[model samples]
Target: MILSVPLSLGGLIATAPSARAVPSMARQTGYECSKCHTVFPELTPYGRRFKLGAFADSSEKWDERPWTQRLPFSAALQGSRTSTSDTAAGGTGSSDFPQNDKTILQTAAIYYGGKIMDNAGALVQYNYDGIEKRWGVEMFDARYANGVTVAGREMTYGVTLNNSPTVSDIYNSTPAWGFPHTGSAATQMPAASIVDMTLASKVSGVGVYGMWDDLLYFELANYRTAKTGFFRFMALGQSWNSDELAGSVVEGNSPYWRLALQKEWGPHSVAVGTYGLVSRLKQDANVPSLGANRYRDIAYDLNYQFISGEHSASSRLTWINERQRRNNAVISEGLASNSINTLKTLRIDAHYYFRRQWGGGVQYFRTTGSTDELLYNTGDSLMGSTNGSPNTKGWIAEINYLPVTNVKLALRYTWFQQFNGASTDYVPGRNASDNNSLFLMGWVLF
Candidate 1:
């Protein structure tokens, strides 16, 4: 018998102050982080001027190729199209005849980053799914740092559980070159069915991060898996039997947290933050009315960036609070129970860049919730009444192009609408005012 795994030393002691305040753009500009991260998990400004020139390096000037043995690769390509009048049954049904509105090839990814020592570094990703032919592992990051000891003590650190970030198109505001690449009824929730609303390529856990200087940034995590699973009749389409999902078991402890504050004065840069997640669940004697669930979410975001030269602009806003609870339920034949669920969201995004390889953007989202007051019961004959109203809205528009500088091309359009003023014709014969639809996409990066 041999099985042992345990190595997280608080995410390797928080990667030593951003690895001793940045050095090695391969030691100055020998480049990596994909020469500005189209996706090494997103970042650009020549990767933020190789991270603000590794936090203001003495005065700049270091490119003589320090550790050059070579290794860094990247690639991406995408496509899309959609215009609709709403139609549904099993899947891939609307697009209103005409061979379903055309245009495809969604996502393709390939990545690699460098440095094995001299402090440590790594970033790897591989994804290819031409409509699910499969090829996974979307992320991996490893870091370490320790330098600068007196003078206000500068520090940086790291430890990652891959899959990184918030995942829904990376920190909400949607549109990462969109389409039906998952809609946003205020960040996913159309009574949530369709496999509990996709997107969340991965999340495994193990974080211990830090940053001190640009005004503090922090993280402390635990996560232990969550690709997505939290069911409770998903509005009412029923299908949750695998002993009732949610964390599937491995004991407990699932905390996650984050905090941030950033600064830059010249061209103006700002950041504000908060992050969250807390979970616990267990108990299912063959789902005896099922219970024992607890979940939480909290968020806050603000960003601003504008640089002249070729021109650039960015603006963002996000706020969310999601909660869930169940605590031991059996409720009848023997009695035992509890319940509560909640959701609230708001998002806004905008971007603009010209001549530095064309660009455009826009996004808006809103959500409201509260329903399921015992959605159904038939002890007396037929008692099925559940209606809680809270509207939902979504919108997106985008365009991008960069012929070279590590290739990029994009186009996107999306719209979704939901109103619970209670109306049902159940689509058996059509026209209940046909809901709404329109999604389009196209992308390529390398």
Candidate 2:
């Protein structure tokens, strides 16, 4: 069975921080990358505040001039090798794990980030996926921010326009900036929460947010599928498959909301937050008259960081639960076993770095959901779930070394304990461990 939701946006497995670690951001603030990052893309408290302020704060008076003078541009390149425990049976070069045991250029990307005006700023990105062999805009965020006093307390508020739901968030605990920051594009992970980068680069959003007394943060936003000419232009001519579009059509706009509380004392910082998305989509893009399917995804998360002298460490936890109302998926689409089903995802990660030069981290992840044979029971060995269950659990361990502030090398390994429905013979003869992988990478930014 094939189920397409209007904002499916392909798999989120390959999503990375296009705007994070941009050298231009460091130049703009007159600070080293360490000022904003504990590790390259992970933000420090000051980094979060910089983003919350719309990236407008600057150290140079010349920032008031035209952006061209500042040369607010940066680029990134990546190369990696992937090795899976077992290649799919009968698999060839074009099959699953195409680059298994092979090294290849993984990505090439260009970024633009700076203050558009005194009160406005934006981060835009366009990149090439070496594995998919495609070039398109994958990240864009424009904002206007200002500060005000409310009840004698400092309040920072802003308006944001961007692609991707959590792209504008200041926390790395969310999907957009979550752990396992980088992964092999040639490898595929099964099962993900609908709210976890599922709609990234596939939709456009507008939001308003405020941070009061540096204590509470709240945001409200709405998103719509980017399928039309104008919206597609906003997405920088990203292409969509005709059949894929015809399979799942967005009915209308979806609402996304966020709330968080943060506190910092000396060298310790902590945050707790909740966010959600509600979407209504046409069950069949070909048969809009069939009505729509409703998806409600809610998540709770926690973030903590410790920084002192040459040591820095952070930890994150995120749990998501999605309630599905298969209005037409059951009868009209025949893609679900029940009218209502619930899916849940949990992730926990932590890492420590010394002088921003060396570090290692680990992540524990799992996903479980209601069984629906019609939707998940495909006989395909590699991507199938013989038992019609959506249950998967895994652990990832990684070690990193930075030769310089702009260059990094990493070795990471993923171990799967459960996949699809089982650890042993999830399919006819393949065990989940068969998909375990080791990835080595080199990433450079300038």
Candidate 3:
């Protein structure tokens, strides 16, 4: 079936590789994986440029490449075990850890990624979520990029069509490529901002971006629900079914924008950027008469990288502020207690690596927002807030050992200092620390 799909598409689907770090790219460009990454999935300056160029850069002649080289296919597998500090209330540990202390194959994915033409490239992934027991199209990014001289300054411009907002971004500070690259399928954080992963894989976006003098960058795009047209094919096998999306329809095109300034000096590189989105969506597709809910999200981030021989280090800081206006009519309908609410998130992390084989990192994250019982409280002890406050604070620490460039083993711990606005008794008797978890994970790419 996989072979049939590519054959049916013919040359339309050509040599492509993984979106994250994979060997197919190295084989095509005649460079080692380290040339483009400080570690697996973490890009260095050169790696960022390679992606900004639409992954079209290559060392060999395109027409002369062999069939094997032309089909840059790769597969990835992930396994992990998660253990919480304490069992769930009533000994029903399944609520907190469906497969606690059990090593399970969390994910398996196949990727077709790389340059399709002289000026075009793409990355497509089909994945299986072992935990969910489902298969789906995980991510897709296709682009047409080129370089030109604008006012004597070099400018690289491109148009990106993707299923997720930040999937096409070159910076790791963004949501898609942010830290804690891999997570336990057994557990999850409760609160997240709208700009986080809320719209990932749920909508399609078409954006135009440009980088000037390798110093300034800008992008603008519009997104719409991916229920029909080409987007439907791109979004095939999504986690959300059509009926689920129907209840929260994106009424019209949502606008997204980005701007950034970056510089590199010797072994040090730095980037500062801002990005945002504005959308109006149907509060309830069941009630066509109700007004739409409006959301506005704004974010700023900073990234820094240092590289010297076998030593590499990086840091990222990002903050997102979101304002939501619930439909007044819906509020009156007992759907919400407040017509307007706000949520904000902050994340900071630092990482260090020695020879790209051994690495460690730490991350601090926090989410704070308005309190509204109808909106934030669900009455569930483990996954919900008892005080109607959307506040969570935590830190993650991890260490990794890579036997090879394509295989990684990591040990990580997450500690929650506060949850749902309180450190102790956040719920009736459960404390935030009860959710602290330890995770051990392994990955293989070939």
User: lDDT values of the candidates?
Assistant: 0.42, 0.77, 0.74
Stretches of candidate 1 off by over 4 Å are 1-29, 32-140, 143-160, 163-357, 361-393, 398-416, 419-446
Tens-digit lDDT string for candidate 2 (279-332) = 876655566566777888889999999999899999999988888787753455
Best-to-worst lDDT order: 2, 3, 1
Name the Cα RMSD for model 2: 2.9
Sort the candidates on TM-score, descending order.
2, 3, 1
Top candidate by TM-score: 2
- Winner by lDDT: 2
**Candidate 3: which pairs clash?**
16-113, 16-114, 17-113, 17-114
Runs in model 2 lying further than 4 Å from the true structure = 1-19, 64-67, 89-94, 191-196, 242-249, 284-291
Worst 10 residues of 2 by lDDT: 1-10
Better of 1 and 2 by TM-score: 2
> By summed lDDT, which 10 consecutive residues of candidate 3 come out lowest?
1-10
TM-score of 1: 0.27
